[model samples]
Target: MLKCDFQYQHADFSLNVELEMQQSLLGIVGVSGSGKSTLLKNIVGLLKPDQGYIQFNQHILVDTRQNIHLPMHRRKITLIFQQALLFPHLNVKQNLCYAEKWLAPSERKFQFDDIVDLLDLNGLIQRKARQLSGGEAQRVSIGRALLSSPNLLLLDEPLTGLDVQLKQQILPFFKRMKDELNVPMIYVTHHLEELEYLEADTLQLNHGQLQHN
Candidate 1:
């Protein structure tokens, strides 16, 4: 489970949110700059809260009063940005292997071949990261994150730049990742169509606050 009650301030906006999420896909919906991405970043430890706490499975990732703040790598949370963000010099397989290094030998839960198969990445394995199409790159990115065995996956408008056809192509794989892999995810998007396909519980953000129905 994940629980958070935190606040952060920016030059133009302040983020104040409290939310409790269990082991399931939880979708965050809001307009651009409504603090949705900031919330995810905070939970993932990319940003520290000015006050309050963040707990995941009883681990206190951040507690201002206790002066506890875990770094991003130690938190075991993965954030997938809107862009694929693959290493331009690395091949697809190399990118995936980069994350695999973080997993303990005994805890390495995912097989490389299995990830390739799951993401339909066989044909792109040998290709340079720059050679892949947008969809292919994003697939590689997702596969790489999965190889790391993250406890929580934060997707920040992953499908934003894709065309409708490409978005449709990748949608099934997201479902496969959620259902077949059972990796709890927090997907941030403004699009309701994508949320419907996820069939996840909704956490709506408005004026920097999180509201659930």
Candidate 2:
């Protein structure tokens, strides 16, 4: 449902990739500084590509030739970073509720309660963001992203700093989101074990290019 053929340059580093994704969970494996994040930023419109285009389903998200570049907010793409960037003052429920404002009632694909349940976050609702464990915070972040009803989810090494136990705890949730909730995701990480656990279709991102793993 997504297609990209773009070239982006940053100082001495350049990212040139051509990728097409169907409605499935895709994993991108790369070492540090391999332009994996750069490719994602370009797709999500955080950084405009110097040339080529990006199409999501039938919508043209970027077309440098036509001078068409949709802003990040308008793309309906949600990005989850390595850290759980939840609002410090907001409780878990409140942080999740903030994402609900992105789509109106009729336009929403997933309900807030369903997301909370899917993430197994019912008990954590009343807790402050800073009061949760690493795994709990990540679950809340995932729930918040799902509540936003994004057409495509981009995860940028979301489980980076978590321990093996914590990563194992959260991996099943991602599988459920793919198997049950049917969320299309592009998960980028250096850990191949995570991809193996999810049984995701794998690709290797090396020197700004994509190849079958």
Candidate 3:
């Protein structure tokens, strides 16, 4: 579970969002510049809120009133950006293995090989990041994130760049991750159709607020 009640200000723009998530998937639909990504960044400690708090499960991540702010690396959180953002010099397997190095064997919830199988990355293992197609790269990216065994996953418009065919192909993998892996996720997107497939608890972000969609 996750709870965030924060007010963040960046020069002329501001974001005030408060929401609690318990479901496996939580979707936030908003137009560009509507503060969806900003909310996520704050949650993961990439950006500290000017005021308010964030708590994950029973742990406090940020509580400005108490001067508590957990660093991004210590949050046990993983963020997948709009772009695949894989390391260009690393092969698919190497990129995936990168996450494992940071975690102890016991701390990991999933095996490396299982992630490869689930994400359909067996053949792409030897391919360098640049050699992958958009969809392939995204799949590898997802595999890499899952391999880390994050307590929470944050995805920001992950399928935005892919064509409809590719999106359709990748959506099922996400569904499988939700249903089979049961990982909790906060998915932010401009597309409502994507949420329909995930069956997420849907919310809309409009002018610094959150409401049922």
Residue lDDT tens for model 3, 1-213? 899888999988899988989899999999999999999999888999999999998999999999999999999999999999899999999999998998888999999999999998999999999999999999999998998889999999999889999999999999999989968999999999999989988999998789999
Where is model 1 more than 4 Å wrong at Cα? none
Q: Which regions in candidate 3 have their CA more than 4 angstroms from the true location?
A: none
The global C-alpha lDDT for each of the candidates, from Candidate 1 onward, is 0.90, 0.91, 0.93
lDDT of 1 by residue, 150-193 (tens): 88889999998999999999999998888988678999899977
User: Which has the greatest lDDT?
Assistant: 3
lDDT tens digits, residue span 1-213, model 2: 999998999999988888889858999999999998998898888999999999998999999999999999999999998899999899999999998885779978888888888899999999999999999999999999888888999999999889989988999999998899766899999999889988999999998888999
RMSD of each: 1.0, 0.9, 0.8
Give candidate 1's TM-score.
0.97
Residue clash pairs of candidate 1: none
lDDT for 123 (candidate 1): 89
Ranking by lDDT: 3, 2, 1
